[model samples]
Target: SRLQIVCWTVLVISAYLVILFIRFLNAATITDPFNITIDWHLWALLGLSASSAVGAPVIASAKAAKEPAPLQQITADGPRIDTSRYPAPVTKAAAAFSRTEAEVAATGSGVLYGKAAPADARFTDIFQGDELNNAMYVDVHKTQMFLFTVIAIVGYGALILNMFLTTTNPASLGLPAVSDGLVAILAVSQATFLAGTGVTNTPT
Candidate 1:
């Protein structure tokens, strides 16, 4: 749920940035034939997109199954206890205990115990059962968003580095120039993250 909230928050921020980007494109003119203008706001948008991409799978991994009640289960059938073999005092104590309590006592000391919570929610683990298929499907999308974000970061970083090294203007070094193709890539990455998460259009 927190991850969903974060996704929604990022969505809202991106929507505002989209409006700003469109306005900038309409009013501003690009003088350089080789360089394209990209603002700090767009960079901020890309960062947010990357963050959302990486967070999705982590959130899914944290949604562990509820821990079952104590003594309700044991990982194995448990060790056998011979009531007749026990000393008089031990036998007396065992006789008064309830079945559940007795079961716990017998198995609790052994190596076998209840299963631990899942360390991560892998797709296969969630997908095998019909009840968890929806969650599995969602996680798959989240994984895609994560991969996209990683690629965007690498590509965007390379472009920025190129601009910094090649350009003379201070503004170019700071805001940098992005190719039309790179711009499309960044836009699509953001959109993919938003769509995969089903984030609302409304700004927060």
Candidate 2:
């Protein structure tokens, strides 16, 4: 889960920084007490961070793909099937909404969808029916995440460009140092995404 991954990342980074701090304290590096040591070996941290950046979204998409079919919640005994409410078809429009029992039984013109006919002679032929049947489909959390990811990539690129053009450190532009900013951005982004679940009542 994202929460577990986030917590573990925080703990690992915190422990690494604490170890560095202790080493700084013990090594008589106090002449510039505020200064910290970070070698290029920290590139390993960057590499892991980059891997997770790519892996997280792929994991989320695979999980979404593996979600149980929506119809699994329905059962034969759950709802009484009433053909009365399902009026006979008026005219053949589309394969999904075209089959009438009379036409099907007499002329053998019916279409079988996944071994079962769709109710009401509507959506009688297509497997899973229309993908856009739900108005909220386009507004799902995944779409929002994807859009924000693109925005973040563009925004970060712009920031890097500005820093290069200005010949000034991030601190001069009221930004946190790179590592701290990365941590803060990831934490906030994760929390924002999680908060949307509460607001939207979306299942994890």
TM-score of each: 0.32, 0.31
Please count the clashing residue pairs in each candidate, in the order shown.
0, 2
lDDT of 1 by residue, 48-104 (tens): 555555664443333222121332223356864443443222123234333243542
RMSD of candidate 2 to true structure, Å = 14.2
The whole-model lDDT of each prediction reads: 0.41, 0.37
Off by over 4 Å in 1: 1-44, 47-131, 134-140, 164-172, 179-184, 199-204
Backbone clashes in model 1 = 0
Candidate number with greatest lDDT: 1
Clash-forming residue pairs, model 2:
96-123, 96-124
> What digit string (tens of lDDT, one per residue) describes model 2 on residues 9-72?
5544654555445445555534443344343433443444455555555543443333222212
Please list the Cα RMSD from the true structure of every candidate, rounded to 1 decimal place.
15.5, 14.2
Candidate 2 off by > 4 Å: 1-136, 168-176, 179-185, 188-204
Residue 53 in candidate 2, Cα distance off native in Å: 6.0
lDDT score of residue 137 within candidate 1: 28
